[model samples]
Target: MNDMDKTRLRINRSLILQEVRIEHVRDFLYQEGIISEEDMDRCGNVTKTPRERIACLLDLLPRRGPEAYKAFCSGLQETYPWVVEKLNSTPIPETQTKTLSSTVLPNKEMNTGETSERQRIREPYTELNHTVIKIVTRSEALNKYKDVVRALGVPQPDIDQIEYANFRDLQEQFYQCLLKWQSREGRNATVVRLIEVLREEDYNSVADKLDGYID
Candidate 1:
């Protein structure tokens, strides 16, 4: 396929993936009465009963062709068995950080002369507990992002490297960094920095194209 055709297919795949994730959330919400039976019914056939429809939607079968959806769901189940479990289970309590203080003396030999030793703040967890929550909460959006990534069929080590909780944070940081980098040094610097931060070839490619017009 031509480049434009390929781009469109990637976009479509992303949209499909996002829809599937949103459907899963919708199913969970419906089960909890967060959404009404009427809204649930509006989602339409993927199953014989309303309850079954929840499963069908989460499985992404109603929209995808049966065979493909089945295979995809199976593969996803294998890859992320905990996804449903986590979604269904109660969310964990948010962790809190504790600040500890240490005695410090100012001396040329003891404290490097002037600056006081900073107290180390211990994190409650090795990583943020909310990372998974954010991932689950934003699954629909991330799934859309994943679709584009999947279409490229190229490894996205950087995207994989980010902690799930940090996805939104990282994106925000990158945007701010891009604005600063672009303003100071122009398009080339901004594109390079964006690629470094995003670590996705597709995003880098797009950033390169948009570089000139960025302020």
Candidate 2:
């Protein structure tokens, strides 16, 4: 096969491997009388590389036609819709950095410290959102930001913690953090609300994605 064909096949097999454990596929083949236990043991060895395991499964499929393999893949799609959706989504490239500070942050000269801090905040645009204003109260998007505060020595917030305030004030506090890391200006004097935003974040980088921030 050509290089493009080989890449596509590798991607396909990787996605397949995510949801179809070797044992399940082997058991199906064995129960179907398509492969003997000995054949499975030889071909479906767990120690083998992923490509090899997938190739072994392919060998077990009907050699006479592609229909059997197609049916098997179709069954996987029917059974695991989420896996199928993940497979269909485009894979993120390691080299790409999805930044939004240009569009999200207003155009104005920033101090050296703010610029340096902003430079550290790298992320994939798809996963990172700047919706502090629009996000619903129930949304867990800011969970990590809350965790950051807790790590900095704030106690764990009590469950169902009620801090009654006007909805507009809440939005303003959130915006202050998104625009500036602090939230003092966003609240009424009698009703100070605390909010947090992070910069210099892996919440922007692949490493940040793999290990997460605060690692």
Candidate 3:
């Protein structure tokens, strides 16, 4: 890849991590033979989280022969139109911050501290209550609820109780766990905090994605 192409990917890394449905992109690349089966498997399983998986794939792509960049852009079109748009547009100057602030904030200058504070204030970008419950429950359908709840620091006894209460339905078990956490945390249960805990547990993909759910 050329310097500009590499720069483009770097600039859009967070947006890709946040907005793109990675599974779809992976499949598209695999079908086109841009990435081999082994490459796909490693990206899916060897990586601990979605964030890691995306990073892994991005790392692999730049070396997958000359067609890699073109194939990646094509794949993005299927599930990440905005990413495609950004990639096609002018690259952000390398001297700029290259964070999502460029996309959310207007074209203007600000000191680093002010930018960080305002961005923090805008964080989590999503409503906490029922929306979080829905997001976790829906996203974790194929994952083990017990592990997720444990990672979230739910007490083992509470986890056991929830398992017993919803033994037949994993989604319900996860749903109940989030509800319990929300109840206990009360106003402190912000999406930002939830994301922080998830990242601490190495659920970086989930944490990275939380902000993209703004709607």
Candidate 4:
């Protein structure tokens, strides 16, 4: 795949809308000079909701420049390592060029507070990150994510959006639900808590499976 296709393929649009703090993404991209101040304002002001802003941002990235894709990944890696992980996992075709030309942008250091905020967002992912991945993958197969999420009290609108986004693929729908929960809960999205929710949803077998990872 070429850069543009690779860019679109790597970014899980629905997951981004659900999980990413778009403000941080915007700031990072702006600092990298991938997006201009006017672009930033349009992304924020043209869209009312967080989801809309992220969607708008994603739409803007491909058209920004060739380096936009790489810069986007760099910014995401700082605050959303899992997102970068997912993006990197996308398979590139053998025909694709191995060497991508890098364009050096102007140096604009992120301020102390912006740096701190990225650090804060990254901390929660350090623990239980792998476990959450395993659980989401395994739970998707079990097809019980809907029950678990509903029992965990995901808002109806979020649930509706999840259904709408991945209508044809049940597994993807489940994955989206877990991401929604994780994004919404942040540090509170613990493996123990997920297990509890599963059991409460009467999926003890699933809960037991997840419990094994804790030990």
Give the distance in Å from residue 101's predicted Cα in candidate 1 to where it truly belongs: 70
User: By TM-score, highest first, what's the ranking?
Assistant: 3, 4, 2, 1
In candidate 3, what are the lDDT values of residues 118-189, reduced to their tens digit? Answer: 555564453367766677677633275554444344555576678798878878888888777667667655
User: Global lDDT for candidate 3?
Assistant: 0.66
Over the stretch 22-120, how does candidate 2's per-residue lDDT look in tens digits?
A: 554566544433444555687777789866776776544432111334334444564666654654464643332233344335323332335444433
lDDT of each: 0.34, 0.38, 0.66, 0.63
Which rank order by lDDT, best down to worst? 3, 4, 2, 1
For candidate 4, the clash count comes to: 0
Task: Give the C-alpha miss distance for residue 9 in model 4, angstroms.
Answer: 4.2
Off by over 4 Å in 1: 1-143, 156-158, 163-165, 170-215
Shift of residue 42 alpha carbon in model 2, Å? 1.8
lDDT of 4 at 20: 87
> How many clashes in each candidate?
0, 2, 0, 0
**lDDT tens digits by residue: candidate 1, 1-215:** 12222232333443334334434455444333233344456555554554554444443322221122223334445444554233324232233111111222322334344433331111112121233223322333232343222222212233343324356674433333223333444423322233232333234444443332231
Among the numbered candidates, top lDDT falls to 3
Reference-based TM-score of each model? 0.18, 0.28, 0.41, 0.40
RMSD of 2: 19.8
